[model samples]
Target: MTRTSLRGVIAAIVTPATPGLDPDAPRFLRHARQLLAEGADGLNVLGTTGEATSFSLDQRRGLMEAAAAGLPRDRLMVGTGAAATRDAVELTRHAGDCGFAGALVLPPFYYKGVGTEGILRYFDAIAEGSAASGIPLYLYNFPALSGVPYTEDLVSALVARFGGRIAGLKDSSGDIGYARRIAALPGGLDVFPSSEAVLDQARAGGPFAGCISATVNVSARHAAAALHGGDDAALQRATAIRALFDGKPLVPWLKQAVAARMGDPGYGPVLPPFVPPDPAAVATLVTELEKIDKAPARP
Candidate 1:
């Protein structure tokens, strides 16, 4: 299977859960299709927003397989990062087998202070194991949650050693400067900053490949408009929607908004370690989002 460079507004989509919480495939596909139709250039399945780490290897693979079979393969990038090297390799290989465009991988998060060498070795194993599959690997750099930041030297080292196999990096650190430095690297690595706010820069043919955002789940239309058309109004609206989740639990808020909009309450329950947002809060969020959607563009 051939892979292409994934760019534009990629939604870090939410996974719909069954009563058993085992990934409702039908609901999952429906949501995915809707997001693409709504203007997401691609879907990042099982990423942070999708609660990837909460699910088992089998569960992740199952959802991936279902998505590949149902959705357009070239537009899907699945999160295959695991605390275990073997598990990460397996999930990544399965992603390649399912014909996903790329695998978004996080560094080993369970052990803190392993240093860059340890992280390099972890990615080395992933590259060596999944080499036969030939799936491009996009490094996921969310240091706050993982406690292991991929420093500049570490990123350069990985790119130098792995070359094109090390495809890109997603900087959810919310630091655009760091992301820009990675994007300016000698190699043609696609650096995706994790915010819709950068869409204008990306649309202007700047260093950023595009954005990989959780909020794109709700604001795909505005994101696409901003990214492709230089629509400042749309950009402002997308940024506003994202800002509303500040300091609150993001997953629950996203899930609640998705459930309320999609009219599927199954999307409401989050995996443990994340409690559902208050109904009042969700109502307020939905109301504000509606206003953003309806409000006229700035004069």
Candidate 2:
């Protein structure tokens, strides 16, 4: 059955790359299965961490097509946002047609300082043009990368117009207050903070649906614990693990961490813009992460 609540730890897993640096479908399914086994309630595939934009539309769609072979479509939320409107719609439509749970979409990021009307028009165009006409569309908000913030007013306007299809907003702004404010907004919007830093607070009082976190790929246990009001210490440790990469590049570190965890060498290649760090750097990071991995599980 399709999961409708949207409350749970949804991991923005990294795209497992092949030796040729292509998106590997079998490897992705294996990663998804591992995350699920570790306690991820759902998988947010093709996300920022997954480097969705790095792959061609056909590659992304091919992965989507192959996902249901091993991953459950009802539990998959594919990142279908693109810098171009048509590209976004095409990917979003693919997610819908694949029978996945939701499509995480970002506003077109081509021209900085584009008006809110243009942003709304972009969303409107996708809603009107795609097979996502009936699917859940989770707006992806990452001002740091997209340079286009999904302001509260724009969110309300989009929801007001397309409430049926507007699933909710996934805020990667790393601003807890912004996430809480959106969570507290009226209507059926489900707010998901991108990081686990705000997880405890959001879980305790905010109207948060859950967290859509990149770290959850490795630290799902703590995130799941926080959601259930379990050990804060465990959650804090998980938060600290993420902080280890502070000031360092996040995506590459995460990819390296994955490689270390899986004992595979091929998981090192990131797309062009974000090249993989040297092996010595990766070895240093893996060594650092080993301490946490070897630590005792808190009750």
| lDDT top scorer | 1
RMSD of each: 1.7, 2.2
Candidate 2: misplaced stretches above 4 Å? Answer: 1-5, 131-133, 202-205
**Per-residue lDDT of 148-255 in model 2, one digit per residue for the tens?**
899988888888877768887899888878877776666667788887766666565657778898888778777777667566777786787777777877778888
Return the lDDT, model 2, position 240: 75
TM-score, prediction 2? 0.93
Backbone clash count for every predicted candidate, in the order shown: 0, 0
**Residue pairs in collision within model 2:** none
How far residue 47's Cα lies from its native spot in candidate 2, in Å, is 1.2
TM-score leader: 1
lDDT for each candidate structure: 0.90, 0.80
